[model samples]
Target: MCYAKKLNFKLKTCTTLSRVNALSSVAVKFAAYLCTIDSPDIANDYLKVQSLQEIAALIGTTSRHLNRVLQKWTEQQIISRTDDMIHIKDWQAIQEISEDIRFV
Candidate 1:
């Protein structure tokens, strides 16, 4: 019983860490995408089409989970969303969130 409990605890911890790492990676890449806000890559007649499902697939996660992460960013005013489009409210903050990585 003791061994089972230890193993379960380790497994849960590993799962949690994996989720955190994955979410961090997604956040970084998402910020990079936002950097293209004014370019043709994101601009479609001045509206960026950023689909949650597409981004989730790129980040190797489900859209439902990615949505939660995005919601938190939205709550903090990091990004604004209108339907499937998104606009970065603070590019500098996003760069900081992405650990100062070059967005180009």
Candidate 2:
């Protein structure tokens, strides 16, 4: 019985860590996408027609999750949202976060 409890606890801990890692990866990818928006090598034409939901899907996250991440960024003044658009207020910060793997 004690062994079973330990195994269960280990499973839960692994699951939690996996979730954290997945979210971190998603954030990094999203930040990378934002950072490269103006890069000459990056094609952004798809963004012109994609809605937030479509973009979120392309990024491998749900729209609600993407919105939550954006909301947090707005609170931190890293970006601003008006209507259906998002403007990066701190390109350096976004790039740093993307490179440093910082979630906020």
Candidate 3:
């Protein structure tokens, strides 16, 4: 490829990777937010947030996408949902998934 074409391809590749990374980050951040709020010390695993829509907005993702992720987590036995509330069943797993991302 010509230099310009090579550069363009590289740019496109970088952009695609960035987008993928960002999407993954959103999930991790959301999980981190949940793990952060639910404290074992308080014996509370339920999320205090009002709605999945609100959390989706906060994480810059669609509510449908958030729900899908939640479903996957539920299947993995990482969490359980009742109505609007989400209970973290595997806090350690979520924390591990969240990696270095921690809530303030």
- CA lDDT of each candidate? 0.60, 0.65, 0.67
Pairwise lDDT winner, candidates 1 and 3: 3
Residue 22 miss distance in model 2 (angstroms)? 7.2
Per-model TM-score, in order, reads 0.54, 0.64, 0.63
Better of 1 and 3 by TM-score: 3
Q: List, residue by residue over 4-99, the lDDT tens digit for candidate 3.
A: 966865564344334434646666867766666664544323223477886676556899888888999999999899987778898788888876
Candidate with best lDDT: 3
Lowest lDDT block of 10, candidate 2: 12-21
Q: Cα lDDT for residue 76, model 1?
A: 95
Model 2 deviation from native, Cα RMSD in Å: 12.4
Off by over 4 Å in 3: 1-24, 39-48
What is the model-wide C-alpha lDDT for candidate 2? 0.65
Tell me the tens digit of each residue's lDDT in model 2 across 1-104. 39886587556434433443465655675786565555566554433224788657545689888888899899999999999889999988888777643211
Give the per-residue lDDT digits (tens) of candidate 1, residues 1-90. 398865875564344334444535667756654554444543323223347775565445688887877898999998899976767798
Better of 1 and 2 by lDDT: 2
